[model samples]
Target: MQIATMYFKDRAQLKLQDELLQYNLNKSKGKFVGKRAEAIRELDDFEATRDAAKSIRQRVLDNLDTWLEIFEENARARGTTVLWAETPDEVNRHVLDIAARHGLKKAIKSKSMVSEESALDHAIEAAGMKVVETDLGEYILQINDYEPPSHIIAPALHKSKEEVSALFAKVHGTAPKTGIQELCAEARAVLREHYLTGDLGITGANFLIAETGSVFLVTNEGNATLCTTLPKVHVAITGIEKVVPTLEEASTLLRLLTRSATGQSITNYVDILTGIKGAGEFHGAEHMYVILVDSGRSKVLASEVKEALRCIRCGACMNHCPVYQNIGGHSYGWVYPGPIGSVITPMFIGQEVAADLPNASTLCGSCASVCPVRIPLPELLRKHRETQVRLDLRPVGERLGLRLWTWLASRPALYAWATRLGVRVMKWLGGYEGRIHSLPLASGWTNGRDLPAPAGKTFRELYAARRRAGRQT
Candidate 1:
């Protein structure tokens, strides 16, 4: 789904009015945040492990091209077809070409944000094949006519249980079950046939191991395992940053992924695939293809914010962000959202297209605190702002005002006098209530809350007054 045409300010204001959406966002993030904290507290060495994960990811990025070639060669040795795509158009074309050559009609898919970024499902459907999301959360979003995934790990975290029930009933022509188990069963029954008979199965890789030529898939649901084995041909899609030098390093990152994502020490399933079925394999796909999509990732790795690549898709940062908690994910208007999305959207896409995204934070550092990779998200966002200023992308009035403030801040005596004078002006505008209900250039900030009036005196004035009192005493 496309982002709303309204600017970020208007979009966020409108989203805050949606009581249902707010309820879902709060409830979902609260659960994730609480669980993540507990899981981390239980593990004494999570921070040390995070350091190891960071070091491993850094090493991979240091020689990304070398490791990628190593992975491709090893994967080829095991009879896997590896395709390197430099752009979204190239990636989609490659997948469609494979589908058309094989004459595949239907496919079962697990959740893949990389696929979402490439708009792969839309491309496949445009090519005239039925594609179904087997993961229950993704299944909900797909059937809802591509309602954007609101959360990274929990796509349907923005929808209430009742909402899911109603949506399923409407789409599947069956009564919605009240219980979670029954609900899953209902979805399972509906998707089982498609999983068994689809011409191809598509999934995403969590980590590509170069040493073993294996792609790892981690999920709570068993659907990924099915997608890896059920169909005659299986396709695994992931970003170029997913490759690591060895399996042991991949394992270390896996420990952090689940704990930071869902609060569990480990997820329900972890599947490692070396290649297609061999001569005597009883259960496996006959052919396997792994697509490494560079769609803006190569550029990201080369930029100042290369550390963003250390992200394991854990979703911890999003879960703790106050801004994301209030406005939800769709407001970001892209495949990724929250803190990481804010950083990457401008870099991957144009800074002008998602210009306001970097400004959508409180700079509270909640995201950084929760991040397992030690990325300085607030600093990266500040850099984006600096780039915007350098490009003169901000409004002319905003630029002039900032310049004036900078000039005033440089002179100490003038600054003290100006702040005191500003306090008087503010007190006049704010009235005896001591709160500003409205203000120039910031109506949005005070729309639902009040800004406190400035103190009557600046710190320098207060200190001077105290000094005079002490001398008289």
Candidate 2:
């Protein structure tokens, strides 16, 4: 089965997701708490910064058309070729066209969620080019022979350090060790070789600056620089939402992004690579191509759900979300997960395919509170659910139950009768304990929960009793 299909349809994916969630809860025990506290402490003006970033993003979105045009003009002036792709197929063809033109055999890749979304690796490999993932996380995932990334910031956050060591040991023929320094050294040595031998480099931009037409890439390791500098051809794949109005605005967003994400005042490296440094510099991607993919951003921009595009992919919502902290990213089974995933996945894959994603959230408003852009994620998720219900995507049993509830709620007599019946049933089932240990229709819930018996008197009865007592007094 296709990865998309397997992700959406297979029950094992859900089960695996559950297992992975439990695993993460255990692994992130102390580190997660520490990071969260650090985030709160490090950013003294978090709210102000977040507000500033939100205001800047809103202004950029309002003038996206103007900014994009300005960005294109600047990028071209910088001696870089820019390509626009309306669809994933177009994007694949464009990249493959470039590869064929250059007779590219091997391509080195930095971590790119856009490329993952477009399935670029598969396309390049099919076009007779070998693509190597250079980021330590990406390389480990690639070698373990697995699926695309689950998290936006930390692609392999689901996998523990030990799991990574095992993957390295398996791919490099060494015994898995628990030492992170040794494992990182091994990965660096292996990825350096790929970087030195690569013919083309592909990367994703954290932000595309309209003022300077510069792509800002933030990374913990220097892999992004290596990817762009080593190969003779550099290709950047990114969504249209990545565009910002100015370098200053992008930097402001970056300040909040890294801090909210991992509580770092700054990332390990922040580089702004313009066009070729020199005419004869055969080192970098001799021809730098930036593929701005619209895939569905234009439609998103035109809809009420457009606020979702405001996301900067910081993963703060996921880190703070009670649901995400419990279930992790894999459960959603998409490129983006957590609350943002719930709101946008359906739009990307269609409502029918991602119907369950919206229901995944608890609507506790935690996502909205933590969102740096204030995307109103819970509201958007509620909207997805309402849309699903309108389209009859709800299960028959659930729909029928809701209809039955509505019908009873509309008729006071019928509602009272049902309440009395429910009270009698519960009282009989509970005996002297006043709690039902098992229920026929809800045995799963009752298996671990005790249902308290209803009060002998209804609300109306209690009210009448109170009135009589007052009159007697």
Candidate 3:
């Protein structure tokens, strides 16, 4: 909720020192990365499918206005109220207004990143309405002082079974359970009551099908199904970029979405909700609403980083990111985290406040390699760094260091001489062990491990010596 992006360095340092958090992050990385690789390997044509998904996303962005209008028209025809909100406050206002109009007392919610972006739960509680999170992971967070989600797909990835058992024991006033199934059962028992009594259901759409005027919901837990169908009124909120031209396109993307997100060939529940309950229908919402949230998406669409808009929120990039693997998600201090977060967080929030986020990456390119839609994550991060320098958002020392390096890079002789001198100085510092354990300017790197000293000669010197030997031979 709060934009603590400016204190990223401090938070990251604290997270690094947290042993339990590090263990959880490491365990999750192994599960997510290994399963995703296996899932992709089983695909008949993974690259081709990725290409198609990218094309669909780009097409939608290029004609977003037309597709949005078409979606709105079709959704309205199906008796769904379509509302547009340009900001998070507006989104909360719309949800509150709907609740007031319907006299809805209890709201059941599935996991929605867009809603998290809006802090909708806080808004609803402030409005004197009872809001309950139905997703198991979300419920864990809801009771734990409303801690923010650590990962997009697995929100409570940072929490271990022991921690959750303790939390549930305290919150539910029940005996502590160490088994995962028991923990889940406890959560289910608590959430089932809310599901039955809740008058309002709020969810996020995985894909908004323009042709059929349907909102696609994908989940492994089956909670989203109940959230959308059981309540008297259902409200689905998602970014406008989620709209696709047809169910066929949505289907194509779904293949990538499930696998990339949780390594499932298909989720347990996939609901294509069109509108309110029909005359004869018994198991559907009486009233349905779709809120298309802009919230700086238009700015992202028009900016150089528009490729980020193609993100399906599968979170594969974050799953595979080395930086995220180490620091975890909360370090980003926003709804989204990891590589995609580094790119778009600055876009949604101002660059002035979120300038440090873009630098959170190591530019390793692993994120791009695993991205289902082929977003150039490394390039986008570099673009953000460039923007930071241009805006003078970086520290003066960093800017000056880059400038000095650039000036030296332009002069070949001076660059070579400087490298030779630098190597000799490093060799002296390394002493007989040839390991630089501490350095004046690079303590960040040296604080953890030793940096190997440079070899006796620079690359150019070695190359010239080899050429001379060849000529003599």
Give the best candidate by lDDT.
Answer: 3
lDDT for residue 133 in candidate 3, whole number 0-100: 91
lDDT (Cα, tens digit) per residue for candidate 1, span 238-338 = 99999988988888888888989999989999999998899988777788899999989998998878889988899999999999899988888887889
lDDT of 2 by residue, 294-409 (tens): 98888878766888999998887777777767656666777787788778778776788788878876799977887878889988888888888899999998899999999999
**Total clashes, candidate 1?**
0
**Structural RMSD, model 1:** 1.7
lDDT of 2 at 362: 78
For model 1, what is the alpha-carbon lDDT of residue 271?
Answer: 93
lDDT of each: 0.88, 0.80, 0.93
**C-alpha lDDT of candidate 2 relative to the true structure:** 0.80
Model 1 residue 264 distance off true place after TM-score fit, in angstroms: 1.0
Using lDDT, rank the candidates from best to worst. Answer: 3, 1, 2
Count: clashes, candidate 2: 3
| Residue 425 in model 3: lDDT | 90
Residue 281 error, candidate 3, Å: 1.4
